[model samples]
Target: MARPTMEDVAARAGVSRALVSLVMRGSPKVSAARRAAVLTAAAELGYSPHAMARSLASRTSHVLGVMVSDLHNPFWAEVVDGLDGHARAAGFELVINTGGRSPARERRALRSLTSFRPAGIALLGPVVPSPAITAAADIPLVLISRSSRLSTVDTVNDDGRAGSALAVDHLVALGHRHIVHIDGGTGSQAAPRRTGYRLAMARYGLAPRVVHGEYTEAAGAAAIRALRRPFTAVIAANDLNAVGVLSALAEAGLRVPADVSVVGYDNTWLAALRHIGLTTIDQPRAEMGRLAASALISRVRGERTKPVRHLLRPTLVTRATTGPPPAPDPMP
Candidate 1:
């Protein structure tokens, strides 16, 4: 069967082609009753407007292109929810794609979003190179859960330093001096978190041992296995990594919060599960998304040219995974 078009919709609604076009463009000139008729007819015929054609005709678009870093992480989902809600409320729609955390794929994804000539773009936890991101400067851009020194870019990030510090403080308070930090290697915003951990350890007059790892469960597990000596507590780069450490510890016959304690960053739902009970840092994922959307939309509307950087504070969520360090050895 031939695809439905504006002409078909107009014919079905008994309205002129001009009226159908007006309705499709969402022109306020059309009466509610006539708009309803056209919409109903279009729906019945499964007619859909050609977004590209419409955008070209108007020289603008109501679409916001989004590039996500990792599709597997649940934290990004919460962020996307906030972004979607705010975008829709402001008469915009989202077009989403992902890079799966690869720089090459992210560059391609950025080009793809730019090709649509979207009103703006939002990058979620992107690991793409700075030059690649700067190349897409034709439209407004927002970086979510990432940081950039470029004045042209806007960013929304949780205070990674504070988050790491919180974990260290909690562990130290529980008499854990032999704590280890598994760092997110080459990951966005990893430096601040690593710095925070080091500073906190120094403040407590304790030696800090950092394991080089990526932001992944496998990395966390591997880092643990590579450790030379047993530590009383472990601070994972993120919740996903933390879970992996938990698994490794269990396999090693070490019980959490008894034989050892583990803390993670990002209070994702996985960290809150009753069985897992992971202590973590809350980063307000949804709020970060909302802010990113707001910043991008503002620039798209030509409301501001100045850069806006949102650095939100992080708080600790104490759970069963953290407790006093294991008892020392009995008399030799």
Candidate 2:
């Protein structure tokens, strides 16, 4: 049998469908006795109102669609926690899907979310192009950890340039001169971070060396293996990539912080693990999620037409993986 609807509940309770609608919408105009009767009948008959149908009738929806770039990334998981919490408290339901970091897949995911005509849509670390973001102009949309120049989309991001600079400065303060950066090539947050690293190198009178790579552990290991120069320090694009760097160095018998130091961005939970203890730049990911949800909801409620760009500050967290350069050999 098909799922029971409000009409079924109304018939079972000897009430009109309009009364059932009022009760379902939590209208104060309904009396307590009648409301209780409708609710009891609904529960008895297993009648559940159709959320989309109700939204169509009222011209509003409490649904918020969320698209996550990479489901495997722990950073995105933490961000979703904040988004879920804030959206729930405000009476919004979330539906989630992943793009696996591919532009083509992300475009499909965007379409899938928009099909529901949710009150708002949040894209987490999206890799889709700018034009694709612009095409979704009819809905209230927000981008988290991605950027858009379009007025239709709001954005939330930590200052990646500042984060990169903090990593370079930390290594330099520890007597590192031959420092190298493994970049997140083609990733959403890569360009600003790469530019920041280059700027910091110029400011400190040192040559900037960037190895082209993606934001992954495999990329980290491959970038390290491809390096011909012997550097005292390395900055990985993100924590996952940094872990790969450590693995590659270990395979080469290079002791961490004894022969070389390493720094990572996006201080993920993996970075804080006792065995890892990686030094990294901390982006307030949860806070960014909260802000993204808020921005999208404000647009959904017709509170603002202008875009909101939230660029948060990042901090450096020192750990065992970073230390001063190794002592030079004595004169033979």
Candidate 3:
């Protein structure tokens, strides 16, 4: 079957091609009744404008490109929801792709997004090198859950240091002197959280034990199994990692918050599940997404040339996973 075109809509709506083009572009010059008639005719005829061709013709795009580091992580999904809503409300559409947390893959993804010649781009938890990010800044760019020294790009991040401190403080308040942190190895924003954990432990006159791990459930379980000694509490890298810790502890016959309390970061949907009920740090994922999109849009509209960095504070969501330390000899 032949594809419908603007001419078909114009013919059906009893309007000229120029009027139909103006209506498609949402120009205010068209009367409300004419605009409505053209839109209805277009819809009935399944006629829609070609995004790429239109962008090329006008040297403007209504599309925004987004690159996410990990699609498997629910946190990014929640953030994307907020970004999508705000972008759509602002008359922009989103095209998203993921790198699966690989630097090489992320570089390729960034290039692909740039190839589309979008009005702006947003990178969520990207692990690509700084040079790659800086090179991609020919268009408006925003980074979420990451940081950069590049002056051309904007960034939106939750205070990872404060988040880790909250987890440590919660453990300390529960009378837990022996606490361990499962570090997010090479993950974006990992260093600050690790530093915060160490600082908090030192402040409370407690030794800090950190096990290197990735931001995944498998890494969390492996880190737990690799621990030399049993700690009263464990702070996993994130909610997915916390789930892995729970599984490992169960296998070892250690009950959470009874033998060892567990805390996670990035209070994703998985953390709020009744079965999981994880105590974790809330990174305001949705708000960060909104802010990122807004900043990118501002740049796309030529509103600002200076970079804008939005740093949001994280909060702790206490759930069933955290509790008072168990008696030293409770197993006996």
Candidate 4:
């Protein structure tokens, strides 16, 4: 069957095409009664306005492009929820794509979003190079879980360094001295988190052991397999990596919190599962999304010029994963 159009809605509502057009555009000139009639008629016919056509007509886009770094991670989903809610409330829609954590794919995803001529774009945990991001400056841009010095772009991020420090301090207070860190290699904000762990370890006069890892369960598992030194606790780059570490430790016949304790970053829903109960850092994923949307929309509306850098605080949520280090092994 042919798709319903504005003319069909106008005819069904017993109104002129121009009136239907006015109603569709949300023109204040239309009476409430006529608006109701048009809406009802359009609903009956399953008629909806073409957003692209409307955008072209007004030379203004009501769509916001969002590039997600990883689709498998639940963290990004929470952020998108916050972003979508705020964008919808502000009369805009979201077009989301993922780069699968690949920098090359991210560059392609960025280009795809730009082709739509959206009002603005939001990049969540993008790994794309600086130049690629800067090239997109023609459109209002917001970065989440990433940083930018461009005076034209905005950023929303949790204090990664502080988050890592919190985890380290919590474990140290529990009498854990030989704690190892599985760092998020090349991931957004990974540097600060790694630095924080090193700095905190130095502050406590303890040696810091870092294992190179990506923000993945596999990476966490691999890091554990690669460990050569004795340690009582581990700080993973993120919750996903922590879970992997848990699995690997179990396979190695080690009981969590009994033989070794673990901590993770990004307290995503996965971390809160009853079976998981990860001790992790809370990054306020939803709030980050909302702030990113607000920043981009504000820029789209020409409300601000100076870059808005939203650096939110992170907190530690203790769960089942962490405990005092096991008593020193009896001398052989």
Candidate 5:
């Protein structure tokens, strides 16, 4: 069957193609009754607008493009929900792509989004270089869960340093001293959190042990297994990684809190799951997303040329995973 077009919708509604175009563009000039009739006709014929082609012809776009670093992480998914809601409410649509945490792939994804000439673009935890991001400033750009020194682009991020400190403080309050951190090397927001963990440990007069790892479940499990000495607690890179740590601990016959307490960053849906119930730091994912969208839209509308940097504070949520340190002697 041939695909339906604007002509088909206009014919079905007994209107001109120009009237159908006006209704599709959401122009206020169209009468309410005619708009309803045209929409009903389009729906009945399954005729939807081609956003990219429309953008090219009109030199105006109602679409926003989004690029995510990793699709497997649930945190990004939740953030996207908030972004999509706000975008739709503002009479815009969204299309998404992921780079799977690869810098080269992320660069390519950025190019692909810009090719559409969207009203704006949002990058979530991108691993690409600053220059690549700066170049994309030809259109409005906003970053979530990442930072940039560029004045043209905006950024929305949780204070990773403070978030890490909260985790350390909570663990110390629970009587843990010998704690190890699973570091996310080169991942977005990794350096600050690593530095924060080190500083907090020194402030508490304890040695900080950092195991290099990536932002993935497998890396977390591998890093935990590589630890030679018995540590009182493990602070993971994120909730997904913490879940992996739990699996590795279970396999090693070490009971959580009784043997070692675990703390995770990014209080995502997985962290709140009844089965997982992980203790983690909350980054206000939804609000961050909304801020990113609003900032990008503001830039698109020429409301502001100066960058908007939105730094949010993170809070700690204590759950079943973290508790007091185990006694010196192992129970038989």
Candidate 6:
């Protein structure tokens, strides 16, 4: 069957082509009853306006492009949910894609999003190079869980350093002197968290042992298996990594909180499970998402020129994971 067009919609709604066009463009000039008639007719015919063509005609778009670092991580999903809610409320829709945590793939994803000529773009925990990000300055850009020095870009990030310090402080308060931090290798915002951990350890006058790892369960498990020093507690890069540490410790016949306490960042739903209760830092994922969308929309509307950096505070959610260090054996 031939695809329906504005002419067909106009004929079905008993209105002129111009009226149908106005309704499709969301012009307020059209009467409420007439707009309803045209929309109903279009829906009946399963016809919708081509977004790109409409954008080209008006030089504006109702779409906002979003690039996420990893789809497998649930942390991004909460952020996207917040973004989608705010964007939809502002008469905008989101086009989301992921890079799977690969820089090359992220570059390709960025290019694909830019091809749509969206009104604005939001990058969530992106690992793409700074130059690649700067190249997209032609469009309004907001970043979540990433930082930028360019005045054209706006950033929304939780205080990773403060979050890490909170974790270290919690462990220290529980009498854990020997602590290990499994760092997120090359991950966005990793450096701040690592620095926070080191600084906190120094403040406590305790030696900090950092194990290089990626933001993954596999990396967490590997780091634990390769440990050469003794420690009473482990701080994972994120919730996923913390779960991996749990698994590795279980496999090695070590009980949590009894043998070695564990701490994690990013209080995702996975960390709240009854069976796998995890102590972690809360990043306000959804709030960050809303802020990112709001920032991008503000720029798209030409409401602001100065760049904004929103660094939200993080809090600790103590669950069943952390406890005081185990008592030493008294041998004869």
Residue-pair clashes per candidate: 0, 0, 0, 0, 0, 0
Residues 1-332 of candidate 2 have per-residue lDDT tens digits of 98998889999999999999999988999999999999999999988777778787887898899999988778898888889888988888888999999999999999998888789999999999878888986798999988888888899999999999999999999999999999999998999999999999999999999999988999999998988866999999999999999999999889999999999999989999999999999998889889988998899888999999999999999999999989888989
lDDT of 4 by residue, 53-132 (tens): 77877788999999999998889999999999999999999999999999999999999999888999999999999999
TM-score, candidate number 1: 0.96
**Which parts of model 2 have CA positions greater than 4 angstroms off?**
1-4, 43-50
* Model 1 score (lDDT): 0.91
TM-score of each: 0.96, 0.94, 0.95, 0.96, 0.95, 0.96
Candidate 1 weakest lDDT stretch, 10 residues: 51-60
User: Which lDDT value does model 3 have at 145?
Assistant: 88
Off by over 4 Å in 5: 31-37, 330-332
Please give the range of 10 consecutive residues that has the lowest summed lDDT in model 6. 50-59
> Residue-wise lDDT of candidate 1 within 193-212, one digit each (tens)?
99999999999999999999
**lDDT tens digits by residue: candidate 3, 1-332:** 79998889999999999999898887999999999999999999999898776787668899999999999889999999989989999998898999889999999999998888899999999999888998888888999989987888999998888899999999899899999999989999889999999999999999899999989999999988878675889999999999999999999889987999999999999999998899999998889889999999999888888999898999999999999998777554
lDDT of 2 at 130: 78
Name model 1 segments beyond 4 Å from true. 1-3, 31-33
Q: Candidate 4, clashing residue pairs?
A: none
lDDT of 2 at 167: 94
Error of 5 at 240 (Å): 0.8
Enumerate residue pairs that collide in model 2: none
How far out, in Å, is residue 269 in model 2? 1.4
lDDT of 6: 0.93
Residue 9, candidate 5: alpha-carbon lDDT: 98
Collision pairs in model 6 = none
